[model samples]
Target: MTTQPHFFIEDSLLYAEEFFAGLGKITRFSGRTVTADDIKDADYLLTRSTTKVNEALLYKCTKLKFVGTATAGYNHIDADYLAERNIEWAPAAGCNADAVADYVISSGLNLANKYGFALKDKKIAIVGVGQIGKRLTKRFAALGCEVVQFDPVRAELESAFTSASFADVLACDFITCHVPYVKSGKHTTHHMFDKQTLLKLKPETILINACRGEVINNADLVEVLTAGHDLRVVLDVFENEPEIEMALLPLLEFGTPHIAGHSLEGKARGTEILYQILCQRLELPVEIKLQDLLPAMAVDHMVLTEKYQLSQRQFRALMNLVYDIRNDDVDFRLGLAKSPDSFDSLRRNYSIRRELTSLKIYCDDTLYPTFTNLGFNTSLIKGE
Candidate 1:
């Protein structure tokens, strides 16, 4: 009889229980609470970004041969340690690109609505034009917003891609960061937006950071806000997660517990990628499809009649019906004051959020192509 490989996975992963049940004997644990002893005899370990996969946690896992992180960011994993042990590792990059872009568009529209301004009238500066940044550029461009990007590495490779200077980024109406966390190097992103950078920003410039908390110094951010700078900040990731600075909560226009990329489709895609990687490492044939694992969307279809036209505000409201970012904002705001653990708990128990592609919308012919380009499934409806 073939021995069933024992697999250890983080409990927060969506579809993990069902996806891995047939492949091996599975054990799930809280990512942050997992210890070295937990995977002592496990053949494989899978985790999200929350778990720190280092020598300290894996020193006792003598049987471990493969590890996978179901997240785009892998700063938590020590690559050199894994290389020394000859442990094969994979990270699910670009899996959450669309989901994050959806979050940015939703929140951007919300901000525009709240402040009574047209989205097309404002310029957005996107820092680090990687997977997520590229998606944001496409979506915002479709919506007629002026977008400027800053990514030195990508600029070197793609001549067609325009690269804006850091000084130019600071002058924009809104700034969003999507760079990975790099502690040191020529492209070190650690606290890239320090006190000096923050001070240079134009007053009332909206700042959004969903990339990593460390990219912006939280202390500097708090100091800048306290100084009565008219900046509006939206943070999905914080410098210190779970144990976030509570003082910054009241000042934010919107805040979430790092769920910007935790959409149902995104989570499923991450799981599927890791599943494929594990299968390849184990010499097992891949059998699962991502579509097979997804649940039916709670919202299936929407109708836009001739009586109502698709204005920016109306479009935002319609998008909210599919995936409203404010719900997450409210949850974090209410829970953050209660306890530190609430942040992690909120993410672990995040509500089911579907991507825009999951819902079909019936609208006028003029609006169908635009909505389709924005990743919405759309059908033409007669307009009066």
Candidate 2:
């Protein structure tokens, strides 16, 4: 029997080494620190966005057969090179859709509170109508806001989908980006929100980017913010990993170390996606279930009365219990203050954050539809 193919997993994917124990000679390495030499003899590569699986890193890895990224975005992976080498690749796309949407919703609400604006009265634009963006469209529209989806690709591809023009999108009260980072394409998103675009926004526009960093030019953003442009920006991802543009920190309304999809379920779900794909390729039965792999939620059970119904304001308190963007912002700034490379360190030890689906809420049956539409896990109460 040929020695089981070597498996190199990122150490941050907690318990992944053990998860693949039976199938391979597993080695766990920090994603940022792993080099080509480390995977030279590896037959499989399992990694996160932090690890770039490009020719520069994988040229020495002769035995590599399959590469999987436990992330929704695949820009980090050089797909063109992978395809040329006949190496199969897979991304856990949309595995963290709910988690990322939660972050956006939370961030939006936080900004509304600080800016003294009502979300319902605002015209919001979702820049990409993909997984996370689609969920946001539903949630924001359900909350009575006008949502304009700006996805040129989807508009061209989907017969039923409609996209907003760049001019129309510029006039929205808020704009959030969820598109992938494409360097050279008609629909390229890298530095999509550069100085020219950033300056054109209507006054006091709330711009958000949880999708990717270079999607908005960091240096341009710092310069724009420095010039005191009437705009508020929130970022969960940065242009550079581990080391970000330090001057941009104080200018951000909210900044985090790319933890938008760091929810416990989200990360596990991504890994699970890769695991199942690998199992299929190897003709092995996947015995692991996602639910069994998760730990108990922090607030496992919540009771909702008529007073706790889902109003724009009431929902904030509820969401804050699960996540408060302000807290993450503070932590991000503090971490960077401690060390420039504190980004990966912060992500490696990210606190356990459970998705709304992880928490079960007991509520009257009448409100079941409302809660479910907002993506909560709920138990219906019978009328007595």
Candidate 3:
């Protein structure tokens, strides 16, 4: 008799059940206690970064021999403890790199145009040179921007970048952080950019944080803004989700929900990679490709100049052209701030978002000239 592998999931991947059939008998659970119980009788368990997997939980899973997390961050897993127990662990590293890069580039370029400064020749200091950071460097460089990097953990990578110290990064014209959360390490990024550090930034510097919140103390940031610091703060992620200091709300240049890496293309890629890894570990052959898995969506060709004539709400009109996943997140975050207790509900019911690739644009005949002049694509929606 062939040994059957029982697969347990923690209700996070949010993928369709039909897509996961045949690999194993899959069971889904949301509550921690219930999920833990399921893990005890399963041979494999899958989870996201939000679920904490440590020794205590591992000890309860006597039948578990493999673990997989469908997220870029794996800090929740106690690797040292898992190693001693001979359990295999895998994470979807760099899965959302492109998605994040898209967010930064699109938002950055839009802001640049608004500020009257050409993106070309502007210098950027990116902290943390990991998968996402490296991808951002390439994207920014392609747009004719000078990129400097600072990642003490990866000194060897310095050869590819104009690397400098943390102080040097703070002084750059634009600074974006991509560091991970490390609680107890020489390079602990928790509250790394505090009030003292914020004061050092040039008055006109553009400060953007898309990494984990608390990486920069929100309280300190609020104080800096209140004290007349000339920082243009753009945040997609905050120290506390759905909670923003009322005083600081008016000071932010751009604030949105944590959708910087929530693109459908990115999420699907992550899921596909997780599927492959899980199959290999379980000794099953799984063939999954992102292109084959993604559902194509039609893109409407937007004539910026003509659309400019539509409504008086400039932001909303422009947003409608490319509006999808990220915009929904922005609304959800704002809603959460109004109703803090509804966070769980907001996350559970998040609408499925698609990448630009899923869209096919159709430009108006007369407005085609306007789209060409604005450098907007009139043919298709390409991935950034």
Q: What lDDT does each candidate get? A: 0.87, 0.85, 0.69
How displaced is residue 162 in candidate 2, in Å?
A: 1.6
- On lDDT, the leading prediction is 1
TM-score for every candidate vs. truth?
0.88, 0.88, 0.80
Displacement of the residue 145 alpha carbon in candidate 3, Å? 0.6
Tens-digit per-residue lDDT, 1-384, candidate 2 = 788888888876755754688778888887888888888887989898889889989999887899998888776899999999999999988989999889988988888777778889999999999999889888888677999989999999999988889888888989999988788879888898999999999888989999878899999999988998988899998898767899998888999988898888898888888888989999999987788767787578787774345666677777788888899889888888888788988976778587888877778866766667677887876451
How many clashes does each candidate structure show, in the order listed?
0, 0, 6
- Give lDDT: candidate 1, residue 231: 91
Candidate 3 lDDT by residue in tens digits, 1-384: 987678777776656254466776788866345545556786877777667888766677888878888778787899998999899889989878766665666566666666777765578988888988887787666555788888887885455555578878887888888988786778889988899999998887888888887788899999998989989887777776655554555677776566677767666666777788876766777765667766645544342433323322342234345543336546655865787556445555556455434434344454444333322335522321
Query: Which pairs clash in model 3?
Result: 298-360, 299-359, 299-360, 299-361, 301-361, 301-362
TM-score of 3: 0.80
Q: Which tens-of-lDDT digit does each residue in 269-331 have in candidate 1?
A: 888888888777778888878877677776788877743546898879877877788888988
Q: Distance from true position, residue 272, model 3, in Å?
A: 1.2
